[model samples]
Each structure stands twice: as C-alpha cells, then as structure tokens.
Target: MRTAYRVETVRAAESALMARLPEGTLMNRAAAGLAAACAELLRPGLGRRTVARVVLLVGGGDNGGDALFAGARLARRGIGVNALLLAPDRAHPAGLAALRAAGGRGLAVADIAPGALTTLLGRASMVVDGITGIGGRGGLRPVAAELAERVTASGAPVIAVDLPSGVDADTGEVRGPVLPATLTVTFGTLKPGLLVDPARQHAGDVRLVDIGLRPLLPVEPDVAALTPAEVAALLPRPTGESDKYRRGVLGVAAGSARYPGAAVLTVGGALRGGVGAVRYAGPAHAAVIARHPETLVSPGTPAEAGRVQAWVAGPGLGDHPEAERVVNEVLAADVPLLLDADALRGLDPARVRARSAPTLLTPHAGEAAALLGVARERVESSRLTSVRELAERFGATVLLKGSTTLVADPAGPVLVNETGTPWLATAGSGDVLSGLAGGLLAAGLAARDAGAVAAHLHGLAGHAAPMPATASGVTDALPTAWQSLTG
Candidate 1:
C-alpha cells in the first residue's frame, strides 16, 4: 500500500533521525536522491552531447538547502548548475557555501531582470523546485508565484524537492499560482498532498527518498492507496468444496420501468464480482435477464427474494412510495447493506444508526451535498472533510466518488483509489461500482473494505476497457481486472 502522513508527522521522524546521525548525513542522503532523480531525467545515456543546464529555485528554508546542496552535487559531476536564490540573505548559509565551492553560479531574485530570468529558464534541461516545502501554506508569494508560472511554461521537466510548491501538504488544496511538477522526489514518507487531488494534479509522478524514517514514522497514515499485491490478498478464491451458495449470494434491488438499464448494469457488476448467485429484486427483470440469463430474477419485493448473504439497494429506484418501502426493508435487514444512487435521498439518520449490520453508502458529490445539506461545491472542494462528516453523521461507511475515489468510516484512515480513468465519468458506471461493492459485502468483506476494494477493482476494470468505454464494457472487463489484480 502507498501511504501518506501529515507534514508534522514527517518532521518529527526527520528530527529523531537527524539527532542520532551526523549533522549533514540526512541532508546529504536527501540531496543524493534528488540529484540522482534529476540526473536520470536530464542525461539518460546518449551519444556525446554538451553539458546539460540545471536551475535550482532556492528559497529561505531547509527546502532551499536541499536543492542547493543537490545542485552542488550536480556541479561536481560536470553539469552546468545555477541557483536563483529567492531569499538571498535568508538562504541556508551552509548550502550556499557548498554550491559555491563546487562551482555553481547563482543570482539573487532581486538582482535578476525579468528578461534575463526568462532567457535563462528557456534553455534549462531540468528545474529543481526547492522554492517551498511541505511547511509552506495556501499559495506561493506573488514574486515566487510569478517565477513558478514562468518556469512551468518553459517546458523544462521540473523535479519538486518534496511536493509541488503552493499546495496544502495535509489536504491536497491548491490555490493561486503553483508549478505543476513533472516529477516529485519526496523525503521520508509521502505527504498527503502528493496523493490526493487537486494538488495531485500538480504533483505528477512521485518517487520516495527513504532517509531511514519509515520505521520511525507513525503506524497509521492519514491517507493510503492499495497496491495490486495488497488488493490481491483481500480477494477470495474458490476451493474444491466451494459452491455457488458457499461463494455467497448477493441481492440487488434496483431499477424501475422508467430506468430498467440500471438493474441490468448493476447485476452485470455483481455477476462479475465473483458472487455465487445474484438474486435480483426489481421491476426490470426482463431487461436484466436479456443481458444476463444466470440472474434469478425476483417476482416480488427484496424480503420475498429469499436467502441472500448481503443486499444492495437503490441505483435507479426512484423516490416513489414503493421505493421507500424497498429501501426500508433492506435497511432493516440483518445482513450487510450497500446503499447507493437514489437510496441516499431522504435517508433517515436514525434508521442507519439503528442497523447493527455493516452498511455502506456510495454517493457522488451532488448526492453527498444533498445528504449533508451543503452546497455541491463545498463537498467537492473539501471531499475528505465532507466524506468523513457524512460517515460520522450517518453512522455508516461512506464512499465519495470523484477524480479520486475515497472510502471513509467512523475511524481510521481514508482509502483513496486512483485506478479510474476519465472515461469512467459516463452514465451507469456508478451502478456497476455499487453492485461490485455489494457483492464483496455478500462475500464477507467489511463495509469499509468492500467499498474500497470494489472501487479499486472497478477503476482497474474501467482502465482495462476500451477508451471512452461504456458501463457494459467496464462490467465485461471485471473478470480480466480481477485476474490482473490476483496475478
């Protein structure tokens, strides 16, 4: 799993490591990693060529020191290195001395003219952004922001020291001008900003520089993304004695005459989710069976559908009286339940809290906004806070779907899944996710695991499908996605 901690946690670990080691040991280790990454980007073993130029945007803090020291290392290697000290007098004294001794030329930001800076930037092979570290907040200062913007437009591959400047280290919020990095070389543990969006958009490919701090860091991270290997461990395989019944049965209550395809798509996801049987309870039986003949279509309500290990309610079931009745029946059941789509509408907080069984709620930003009685923009802007509040208030695991799929319960860290493609924004895709999550619940995964795992699998399936894939394509790719993860 790829995990991320807040800035303070990373700082504490660094302090403890620095106290035991030599004064410059940690800094040298960090500088070495930064230089290596920059080297790989600039000169990747070609024919005889002229020396590449590297520009370091040096600031006033340790972040600037890291870049300056790394610049010294590059200068020693016969590369042309120059540093633009943003805070000339305040820049790390030791770092500046190191760079000067190793033959790196630098100019303070105050002394450089706009035309000179632009001309210098246009010829760079790579840019090392040590302008601000994780400790910097809100956005870059005006002068620094303008320089960042210019360099970003220069087309040079920028390697961020820790994270991209101007992004919130704890929450991935980006404001004002920020340099979107081509790569970020982070020290110690990954920061939350490097993983979550809209800052994730700024932080491109990430490479971690382990300064012997992983063991010293906190056990629980604020955010985590499951790796393929970790996800594979969570999947169930059939033993010799396994049967459809033993594998587990999932009940899907979805669709209406007005939107029968929701039922078809929802069951499509469940069938491919490795369930023993999919007992579908909805008015779209004929439409569902046309696509999937194996489904045992119910002739009555969910309670009459008979035995099911867990239940999935609401995809396109509208806000009719019958829909409420179906929702209440499923909500009141002893088995685990996943609520999605229209099921999230007018949900009673008391009914959700009363359920002793595991419950998962999947909502897009708009639905989450409605549930929380807040603006849609509010939920989108602060998804982490919004999702957590929704889970705590409703007393159920909440999965907030967006560019990053996040699963949060009342406790522990939030799981962020980045496996999705832009094509997943199509219609009925969420129905597939809801069904897959429900199927996992039926297969005995907890609410949080089911939701997070389903999201991961669903995104992988979407990515595996053809570009601009339909919901049906995503469903068809499920078995492939499952095998890919398992393998």
Candidate 2:
C-alpha cells in the first residue's frame, strides 16, 4: 500500500531527521534526486553537453536553494543552467555561489523583460518548479502566477520540486492558478495533495525520494491506496472444502419497471464479485433472468427474499410505492448492507447507526451533498473532509465515488482508489459498484476493505474496457480484471 502524510506530519518528521543529520545532508539528497530526474527527461539528442538547457524557477526559501544546488550539479555536466530568482535579495547565498562557481547564471525575474522571459522559457528543454514548498498556502503571488502562465505557454516539460505550487498540501485543494508538472519529484514521503484529486490532477506522475524519514514518521498515515498485490491477498478464493453456502450469498434489492436494466447490471457485477450465489428481489425479475439466468430472482421485497449473508439496496427504484418499504426492510436485516442511488434518499442516520451489522453508503458528490445538507460544489471542493464528516455523522463506512474514489470509516486512515479512467463516469455504473462491494461484504471483508477492494477492481475493469466505455462494458470486463490480479 502507498501512504500519504499531511503537511504538518511531514514537517515534524523532517525536523526530527534534520536534527541528527549534517547541516547540508537533507538538501543535498533532495537536490541530487531532482538533478538526476531532470537529466533523464532531456531527449537523447539534446542530452549532449551544452545542447540542453534546464531553467529553474527559484524562490526565496529552502525550496529555491534545492533548485540552485541542483543547477550546479547540471552545470558540472556541461549542460546550460539558468535560474530565474523570484526574490533576488533573499536567495540562498551558499547555493547561489555554488551555481556561479559551476558556470550557471542567475537572473532576477523583476529585471527580465516579459518578452525576453517568454523567449527564455520557450528555448528551455525543461523547467524545474521550485517557487513554493509544502508549507505554501493558497495560490502563487501575481508575478509568480504570471511566470507560471508563461511557463505553461512555453510547453516545456516541468519537474515540480515536492509538489505543484498553488495547491493545498493538506486538503488537496487548489485556490488559484497552478503550474502543472509533467512529473513531480517529492522528497522524504508522499503528501496528501499528490494523491487526492483537484490537486492530484495537477500533480501528473509522482516519484518519491526517500531521505531516511520513514522510520522517524508516525505509524498512522492520513491517506493510503491499495497496491495490486494487497488487493489480491484480500480477494476471496474458494477452497476444495468450500460449498456454495460457505462461499456466501448476496441479496440485491433494486430496479423498477421503468428501469429494469439497473437490476440486470447490478446482478451482473455481483456474480463476478467472488460470491457463490446471488439472491435478487425486485420488480425486474424477467430482465435480470434474461441477462443472468443463474440469478435467484424474486418479484418481491427484500424482506420476503430468502436468507442472504449481505444485502445491496437501491439502484433504480425511482420513488415507487414500495421503495421506502424495501429500504426499511433491508435496514432491518441482520446482514451487512450497502445503500446507493435511490435507496439513499431520506436515509435516517439513527437507523443506520443502530444496525448490528456493517453499513456502507456509496454516494456521488451530488448525493453526498444532499446527505450532508450542503451544496454539491462544497462536497467536490473538500472531498476529504466531506467523506470523513459523512462517516462520522452516519457512523458507517462512506465511499465517495468520482475520478478518485475514497473510502472513509468513522476512524482510521482513509483509503483512496488510484486506478480508474474518466470513462468510468457512465450511467448505471454506481449500481454495478454497489452490487460488487455488497458481494465482497458477504465474503467476510470489513466495510472499509469491501469498499476499497471493490473500487480497486472496479477501476481495473474500467481500464480493461475499450475506449468510450459504457456501464455494461465495465461490467463485462470484470472477469478479465480479476484474472489480471489473481492469475
């Protein structure tokens, strides 16, 4: 699993590590890694000495010092190096001296003409962004923002030191214009902004440079993502001694005459969720049977449905007369339950909180907004806090599904799903994910594990599907996704 720490936690760890190391050790380590990565980005032909130019956007803090030192390293290799200092008077003295001694030149941004700066940026082979560090809050200053825009216009591949500027390191929130990186070389450990969305979207690909801080960091991380191997180990596999009952049965209550396809899709995903049997109770019996003849279908409410280890309620009930009854019955069931789509409407927090079994609520940003009585925009902008608030309010595991799916329990580190494409945002996709995660719950995984694993597999299946993938396409790719992990 990959873990991410908040800015404060990382700072604490860095402080402890620096106390024991030599004065320049940490900065040297960061600079070395940054220079190596920048050199690798130069194309083969341009890599010849004196042919490639690397421009560093130098600020006033340690962040700029790191870039200056890295410029010196590249200068020693005979590559043309130039530093554009945002705060010429406050630049790191030692680092600036080192760069000059190694034949690299530093120019103050204030002194350069706009046209000249644009031309300089345009001619550069690569740009290193060191304008801000992890402690930076809000957006860049006006001059810095203008420079970043010019950098973007230049079309040079940018390598961000630590993380892209103008993004919240702790919440993954972007307040203003940001310099998007082609690659981000972070030091010591991963930051939350490098993993979560909005900020993550700007952070391109992230590479961590370990500087011996892991041992000094805290045991608990603020956020995490499951690796393929970890997901494989959590997946259910049948033993020789196992029977259909032993493998587990999932009960699904979904669909209406108006939207029978929802039932078919949900059952289709459940069948591939490592569960031995699926007992479906809904009005779409024929439609489900036509698609999956093996499903145990009943045209009745969830209460009348026979025994099940877990239940998935609400996909396309669409305010039918019995929809409320079905939700109430499922909530009363002794087995674990997954609530989604139409079933999530007018949900009672106390009823869910009182359940003896686990309850998982999967909501898109819009539904999550309704649940929390907030605007959809608020939930989207602050997903980390919103998910946690929902989890604490309902006392259940909440999965906020989007480009980056997040699973948050009432406590413990929140898990983020890193695997997925924009193509997964299709109609009826949530129904499929509801059934898949419900089946995992029936297979004996905890609410958090079920949601995280289901999201991971759901994302892989999205990738396995062809471009312009549909909801049914994602469902059909489930088996292939399973095999890629288990095979």
- Top candidate on lDDT is 2
Error of 1 at 117 (Å): 0.8
Which candidate number would show the highest TM-score if scored against the true structure?
2
Residue-level lDDT of model 2, residues 1-487, one tens digit each, is 8999998898888899899998989999999999888888775764323379989999988889989999999999988889999999999988999999999999999999989998899889889999999988898999999999999999888899999988888888888889999999999889888888889999989999888889988888999999999999999999998887899999999999999999988998888888999999989999999999999999999988899999999999889799999999999999999999998998989999999999999999999999999999888888888999999999999999986799999999999998878889999888889989999998889999999999999999999998788889999999999999999
Tell how far residue 364 is off in model 2, in angstroms.
0.7
Model 2 regions lying over 4 Å from their true place: 46-50
Candidate 1 global lDDT: 0.89
TM-score, predicted candidate 1 vs. hidden true structure? 0.97
Segments of candidate 1 deviating more than 4 angstroms: 44-50
Each model's lDDT comes to: 0.89, 0.91
Candidate 1 per-residue C-alpha lDDT over 1-487 given as tens digits, one digit per residue, 9 for 90 to 100: 8999998898899899999998999989999999989888777552122558999999998989999999999999988899999999989999999999999987898898989999888888888999998898888999899999889878888899999988888988776678889899999888888877778888889999988999898888888988888888887777899999999999999999999999999999988776899999878999998889999997578999989999999999987778988998999899999999989898988899999998999999999999999999888767777888999999999999998789998898999997977789999999999999988888878888888889999999998888779999999999899989876
